[model samples]
Target chain A: MQSIDHHFLDDYACRNALRGIDTRIKLILGLGAILIAISADTPYAPLFIAIILSIVTVFCAEIPARLYLTLLLIPASFALMSVIVILFLTGGGVPILTIPLPWLTFTATDVAALNAFLILSRAIGGTCGLLFIALTTPMIELFSILRSLRLPDEFIDLAMLLYRSIFVIIGEAVAIYNAQVMRNGYSSFRKGIIAISMLSSSLFIRAWDRGEELMTAMDLRCYDGKFEILEPKASLTIYHILPVFLFLSLAGILAFLPLPFPPL
Target chain B: MHIMEGFLPSPWWQIWVVLSAPFVIMGFYALRRMVRENREALPLLAVAGAFVFVLSSLKLPSVTGSCSHPTGTGLGSVLFGPFIASVLALIVLVYQALFLAHGGISTLGANIFSMGIAGPVVAYAIFIAGKKVGINEIVTIFFAAACANIVTYVVTSFQLALAFPAEVGGFMASFMTFGAIFAITQIPLAIIEGLVIALVFKYIVQLKPEILIRIGVITQERAERLREGWA
Candidate 1:
């Protein structure tokens, strides 16, 4: 929809302040926050996690606040829609709000309200955690970490190849799509289907050609089964590790705390 | 339809990861064997994975005025075997989660299970069955792709229902509610996906029948007949 700005996330990741930190630490912190937020029974901890992670991603990571919020809006909107459905359709305890319609009645019970809040907060927390990682660590850095984690070499190698070729394939696809649009190939639904199928088939052919070229190129280089991936040189500093531990423990403790006020 | 980031609470997500592990492992073994037998399969699989990613990025014009993208797993499954398709789907999905932020790492397992494993396996099965039953190739491809999309959404709905069962009528009612809502948009999208993939198959049949035969999708005799018919 946005003309496929391929470098949007990677641009921030390359430029972020936390880019200097060890990627493994960043991943652990971000993923741990998400796990804790989701597993928590109450909504308070997740909501708190969302706010804290957003602040870190914006202020500390030095990501542009406007761009970060724009990305956050995508998931937030989806969560809001699901929350609305959850609020009205589910029923338990006393009803908090009711609307009488001609064909049917809608009710939002207290239990449903709380459940909706939990879902909304979990979504927010999870999205923030995910964004924090995406904004800080580029995928190139993650490959070595995957290697260190003892993941199979073949799996990692394939991931690397997939990563490298995805951009080229996507560029070819975008070029074809633009050409199709110029010709009014998508003027009607039927035409759109035809245009897309042509696009997909042609892209597949292009990918096949590229794959053959890659294999030939690699073979020319001696056809070794190993791909040499350099590990990032960032050391594990206590300054980064201390803050992550503190923040996660703080969130973990917060999960067990009672809500400051009871919902009506 | 990805289950969104952090949508499935605790045990459900973990369970999906466990359920999906075996298939992914099998995919790895298949991939390893392919490479050991012929190193060319490695780059082909990677590029195919990238193709699936780009396909997901394309917007489909739907009758409901809501645009959705083709999953492309159906095409991948039909072109490559289901096992390799799972590996390709896993790669595409991880990239989608990390780079695009369309899905989440926490829920990656669940998404992979539905889109990567379940959808592709079903699509491959249908494709094979249709061939066995001597059905028309276009009709078979259409149903293979369409049913793949439908089964993906059904599995997603089942996962969500298990996580958030209804207080009034429990898991069954919650599943029906989710299935109904997903059906509203997904049914039309599925039909479109089916048509698009079928058309892609037709183009491949016209241009690269040899590749189809190589992949065991079409027999040599069938390709010869189709080429004669076209000429």
Candidate 2:
């Protein structure tokens, strides 16, 4: 089973030449693309954005095509489910199809279909923007950005510790899960629940102990109440900033371009 | 249960982000106070946040005989308070978005509102009310956990409904549709979460009653009485 806490893309990000690019530039550009994608009134605009973003992410960022495809599909089930609901609930505008059911009548209209398409495109576009950043930037760099933003010390410290402890706790949970499997502790559903409950309870206790030990260690090191870590200085050049400006300008241009299809 | 990326249109997502801001700010204040009062709480809260993230990842057998993940917010809310639970939940949500691709950053504010603010607030309320009514400790824990899980989905449904209301019946119809769709899975998951949380609460009471006392979830006298009974 793939570990939920692990990010395969982060390793790629570390190796990618884009790792040295300023995180702030990436953050702004990514967010700008997402905002444009979301606010785009027409499906064509978002569709264009999604394609361009995908090309940049997979090619420029050196993210594996297979990994990019997998990440894009992560939201498929959710987006499909909501789109289905929207299709069913929305009505009026040249009925495409209708189905009579025992409980309720269902109708699909052109407007509804258009709405679903818009949602799908926008969602994909927004996801592409997010993937571009997540696939290219490491969490430490993101955290450093947060630090540079001058967020609350407590918030940053807690986030740092939480990030570190995730690996530790996941390791502990996996160990217990393997031990349980070896013992056939999950042979039945009831047994599985029992085993999982025990696993969680034990994990909680162990995490608490770990936290205490961490506190003691930090204190031994003359730890102040606040945590302090050095932030990496990112070098930004015109070469790095050019792509962002170009992308933003391209998005703006696409937004104004007339759509071929009739407005929904 | 998260609204997907770009799921909510412009104004709705922004509205949720603005609404959720106060709770997150309050959570910051609560965290600062806790750390100031007890330096040890800093690490404890971090570990607690990690516990939430890990626990949410674990797929447990639901009452419907299907596997589902528990939210884990309720357990944290009971152990800590709602505010700190909200902060912990935001961290967990951010991690999930970054690594698991389970949720998105664009909808982070909405996710925080539902999973972090609404769910934990409801859980905290239920816990307080259940204690005031002198309910069994385990039963109260069960209600707190179960209600929190259910409320998170409920709020999510509302968020979705508000964003994409039905053309004919409007928000109510869409809300009902979303609610019914999620209820099929979430109800059973919530019950299982409740039971698991209750069992964990029992284990903590038996093994580390002092934690409950220290967190002010239970009074020192109450902890002593419970320990004496177990003894």
lDDT of 2 by residue, A127-169 (tens): 8888887778888888877877888988999999998898899
Off by over 4 Å in 2: A2-11, A256-264, B63-67, B220-231
User: Model 2 residue A70 lDDT?
Assistant: 83
Candidate 1 backbone collisions, by pair: none
In angstroms, how far off is B30's CA in candidate 2? 1.2
What value does the lDDT take at residue A106 in candidate 1? 73
Q: Write the residue-wise lDDT of candidate 1 on A1-264 in tens digits.
A: 343436448767989998889988999889988998898788878888999999999999999999888888766544665576678777888999999999977789998998888887888899899999889999899998888888777788899999988989988878888898899988887898899899998888888889989999999998677799877699998998999999999999888777553444
The deviation in Å at residue A53 for candidate 2 is 2.4
Native contacts present in candidate 2, fraction: 0.66
> TM-score, each model?
0.96, 0.95
Q: How many Å off is the CA of A65 in candidate 2?
A: 2.1
